[model samples]
Target chain A: MALPLNYSFRNALVRWRSTIATVLGIALVVFVFVLLQSLAAGIEKSSSNTGDPRNIMVVRKGSTAESASLISRQTLTEIRYFEEIARNENGEPIISADVLVLASLPRRDNSGEANVLLRGVTARGMELRPQVKLAAGRWFEAGKREIVVSAKLAKRFANFGIGQSFKTGSATFTVVGWLDGGGSAFDSECWLDADECRSTFERDMYSSFLIRPTDEAAGEKLITRIEADRRFKLKAEKEVEYYRKQTMTAAPIKWLGGFLAVMMSVGAVFAAMNTMYAAVGARTREIGTLRVLGFRRRAVVAALLLEGGLLALVGGVLGCAIAFYWNGYTTATMGMETFSEIVFEFRVTPKLVLEGLAFAVIVGLIGTLFPAIRAARLPVISALKSI
Target chain B: MSANIVTIRNLSKIYQQGDINVTALDNISLDIASGEFLALMGPSGSGKSTLLHIIAGIDRPTNGECRVQDIDVAKLNESQLADWRNQNVGFVFQTFNLIPVLTAYENVELPLLLTRMNRAERRKQVEIALEIVGLADRAKHLPKQLSGGQEQRVAIARALVTDPALVVADEPTGNLDSHSAQEVLGVLRTLSRDAGKTVIMVTHDPKAAAFGSRQIHLEKGELSK
Candidate 1:
């Protein structure tokens, strides 16, 4: 098994052009690999599978979000007193009024329009979303003409820092502060006081009401109680469950990334395989010399395979560098749950980089095995005669 | 007196490609001394190289008993044959078949890597082989950087690096100019006389064949001793 380990190493170094081309091919494959993984991560993160779970909303029975519905204050107040309702941390019945709107704004990259979901909240709204943070400046005065933009949205938009003014219709308001939400989807939006947003939009009724169970054991009971009240004729679902439905739309994005990665890798595989095959062919004489000198057939094959794996590793490093430079840089996607715009940063974590390199090495294995085997199997007589 | 280091009896090689069954070697038998310098002289397609190849244990004979140093090469499998060749035989090709990427020193060191010798000892052996071929000063020069004669000398060094007694030279000077050819023949002559190698050379050139202590002519795969 004393194969000349330097056989393929020398060939790869000698044919520098083809070697670099193979490396570049693997780099491209790795790039696709990272891109696909990020797409899946983005979609998965956008739909929080945990928050507001089992908390039902009754919005016009069929309306999807605040912008699509008009539920009267009378109906919300009446539902607050329902006997089957649960209590909050304050020992009060779990109910809060909310108004939602679709506010279209110009994208920073393009002049094209993009929508940011605007959720106007009552006083109890702040307590309900407990994990949310006021990262900078101050919360808006109850009736002030100021709004707190999500940290992600503030970073995404142009000139959107504190005290900056933005316009919609005949009204222009100053950005008062910023908010953070522990990486939830709400970080990609703006929050306003309920009455202010209502007056600005000239709406006479609330869009939706959020509910919490007394002990979460009362969740189904509350749902049945709300649905049975025929006067409002409401349809209810847990808030956590409602967001999960967005996963169906997000599924395509995940698959799209995977499909794109596979497609790109095919070209890379061809490049690497073609290069390795030619490399094997060109070194037949050298292979024979090794065998004649005492190298086992499997040793020769393993040496060539190692060479290919090293080439792919180099490409993987370079491709990962390209992907890493993009981490935390914000980019937008359609919020599948709301059909509005959601922005997130590219997250090129260490784990993803390693997986990219691993994938590249696998591609190397696919590229070099057959060629290496052919080289190892060559008869020493004919191979030596090749030169 | 011939010591009979190699024995061949009724050896044949047939290449079958679907409908074509080509006989490359047919019922060839020969015996030579341990340190004899013999030349195989024949025209193209006379199966001289085929016979040399089979004797070197690089190819199997269809029906025969062939032995080198009393070990039956014909009975050995592919891997065993390879190991036998590595320990007992070294081949110099017409093309000087030095790895293009390796310098003269590296090419010689290549065979030594198969041995148990460490890097320091391997370097010493390679130096001796190169010094013997008169290319010790040019050891750093790659095959492409060396002249035709120098390249063939490097190949000769590679062959001698393992200290194999049986050196196979297949048209070793066929690709060289007259000057390079003369230089190569001079080295082969020195190997037989000074190093006591049993050299089997296949060459069409009368001048190259003249270097061998004796020459055997092959006509249509049959040898005339």
Candidate 2:
């Protein structure tokens, strides 16, 4: 017969002092696990959630990221005339030949200088990326020394907020507006006029092209056509797919999260084991009483396991609360793809919280296994003899 | 007056303490009839507890037969012995081994958990058991909240809740005062005389033994009747 569950819970409350240390130890581990995983998830979500599937991106054939991609003006002019390219109401091809540059800037938090990505795009660029929206002020005017900074980026870098001017080399650019990228990678960039950026940076080529396709099949056709023409030395991919690839940039953070969780879990396991061992030692007579009352070894083992699992579950919940509190909390890290600060918020997703809880259960199971066995295998006569 | 509920023959229990072979029970042969209250009296280290444990199926006999309800307990494996004990035997401890965290009602409800009865049925049985022990009003109190005599009563209620044929108690009143010990002994007397339950208790007090239907003394692992 299954033992009453409240029996285990009451025992936990009776020995709460020792239970708390084990619970808190597991809690600290879970807290670090969930938070670090949230950080990684936030970074990955920002990258993968970017761009539309109907749009196509054209970049240098061998380049892994847009920062390293360079397509000359002639190549863009040729690609825009393709029948698969979608046109706006004004009979203009819906295309953005964008430029990307890196600028070192001082952080507002005085945490020293960091590299920031400066993106140059035309009016068509805003049309292609519907995820970006102007949060304050107005979009930057074409051919002027005006730029729109992402709200997240504006908070980090000095002089990047609306109405402020920042210098990149000899040129001065004013932040005319703040753009919200809706948790997309665009939140890490500063946007200005494409032609003006090329002139200021003295670049003769564009970094990439963002194009809207007529349809889904048109996107594939465009890619095939671009790849067939080796002279252009460029490749075309669905914008959504291209952006999803950028999630690889968050790999290190994901690894670090797993590594730290595993490391801390070792300590958590030992703490739980110690608590359970003490519980067994303290309840020697009780064990004998249970056995004498005809409870099988398996039932005794299950009761102790249930107690340990319940304790770790409490820790898991506390850790989840700690992580949940940081939801939407903004931060920045250097992107492996762009080599610049990528602004993002911690996303304490439901799936991640569940993962954290599952991790705690595993630690609890390992911690309780031997101790539960010890309690169950205790000699009934000897145990009853214990005072 | 009744058939044998328990039968033992040539039962022996040996313990290897380091280099010495210590005999806890030696060639013991006995029979306990249904509804008999048998008190086993012995000095310290006389193996009274060990023999009680063996009969209760909490410990194994080193050799020979221990039959309860025609099933040889000595032949039972650990799991089967546990099942046998659960189905046929109840136990009361001297320390009143009531779980300190549980209320009196919950403690009484423990052995009933091994039965297939539902919650409502278990509740009814536990209530009746508490009433029999005259602790029905103290059901909600924790073991620590109750006095030593009250705790022993709760333990008795727990033993009876399972409705077992045999109740094995080791020093059931050893920790209580004279008045409380008499109260506990009175409860055991009712179980054997009125309820027809077989009870085997190990104790040192002759006054406690006087309550039993019959008494047997043990000295150095051999029965001296």
Candidate 3:
């Protein structure tokens, strides 16, 4: 018969000092593991939350991101009037050819400088993204050299307040408003008039086209038509799909999180193993007594494993709780696709918490395996003789 | 006379102490009757404890047969031996090896936990066992909170809780003072006399041996003439 759970639990309490040490060791490892993973999760969430399913994005065929793609005005004109494209109440086709540029700006905290994305779009482009809403002041007027900064970006970058000016490529532009991107990729960029941006940067081509289709079937048809046309040399996909592909930026962070967790868990395993070994050594006589009382070798092993698992579970919970404090906390990292700072909130999701707990339990079980077997294998006669 | 509860024939246990074959028990033959308080007295390394462990199925003999309650313990595999011991044997130790974290009540309740009895039945048996040792009031006290004598009595209660046919105690009074030793010895005597338990105890103390109904001595791994 198996020993009662209370036996393992009380033994842990009786050896509180070592129990706490092992628990904290595992806790610190799980904390680092969860925190690092949450960073990757946050970046993935930021990208995947962007774009609407009904809208389509057109970029140069070989380019991986809008910032790297170039489509000329002629190509935009050739595709803008397709019957599949949706039109506004005023009977104008809801399509926008946009330009993307990068400018290095100083941080409000004076923490060196980071690359910020500048997205120049027309009034039609603003209508295509209903998720981005003006949070303060008025939208920029056409050809005024005025810009609307993302509410999130305004909090981080210098000279982003209303009426404040920042210099980029010998041209000074004033911030006219703050727009909230609803935690989407657009939160990482500043917006101005597309024509003004092309003239100011001396660019002859638009970076990408954002188009809204009349319906899902029409969007699919438009995507298929653009991909099949050999003349334009352009790729078209649902806007949501395009943003989802940008999650590749989180791959390196995911790898780093996994690597750090694996490394720290090795140390945690040894620490737990040491604690269990010491417990077995200290309770040699007790083990023998239980054997003589007719507890089998398996029972002893199971009891010890239960104790180890419980100990690690507590550590897991503590670690998850500690990491939860970072949830919704805003942070910035360089976006691999745009080569600019992408601000996102740390997200400690429920699934991540479960994974952390499972990791801790596995570590506990592995650490206790050999020590528990050793305890069980001890000769009852000799164990009773131990002082 | 009551039926024999434990039978040993030509039992020998040899240890390989790094190539030296040291004999712990050598061709010993003995029979212990039910309800008998039998004490095996010897000095250190005299093999009295080894014999007790063999009879209790905690250790297997190198040769020959040890049958307790008609089951040949030495012939049984490890798992069967454990089940046999759980069903038919209880044990006591000189150190009063009550789990320190558990209270006296929980300590006594341990052996019963192996049985199929429900909580109420187990509680009833545990209470009776503690009452037999006159420590029912001290049932809630932890081992560290009890006197050495009280702890040994609690161990005795634990031994009797499962109502096993045989109870083997190895140096049950080795760590107790004279007064506490008497109290523990008294409890064992009561178990044999009133409860009809077959108790096999190993001790070097003449006074402790005197408390048993019968006594045997061993020397150099052999029974003394």
Candidate number of the best lDDT: 3
Better of 2 and 3 by lDDT: 3
DockQ of each: 0.45, 0.78, 0.78
Superposed Cα deviation of residue B161, candidate 1 (Å): 2.8
Provide the lowest-lDDT 10-residue window in model 2 chain B. Answer: B78-87
Off by over 4 Å in 1: A2-5, A42-97, A108-110, A127-138, A154-174, A180-183, A198-250, B16-23, B115-121, B178-183
Interface RMSD of 1: 2.1
Candidate 3: give the clashing pairs: none
Docking class of 1: acceptable
Docking verdict class for candidate 2: medium
lDDT of 1 by residue, A167-215 (tens): 7534566788899866677777788888888888777788888886665
Candidate 3 lDDT over A93-204, as tens digits, reads: 9999999998899999999899999998998999889999999988999878899999888899999999899998658999999999998999999999999888888889
lDDT of 1 by residue, B120-197 (tens): 998999999999999999988988899999999999999989899789989999999999999999998899887888
Mark the 10 consecutive residues where model 1 chain A has the least summed lDDT: A42-51
lDDT (0 to 1) per candidate: 0.80, 0.90, 0.91
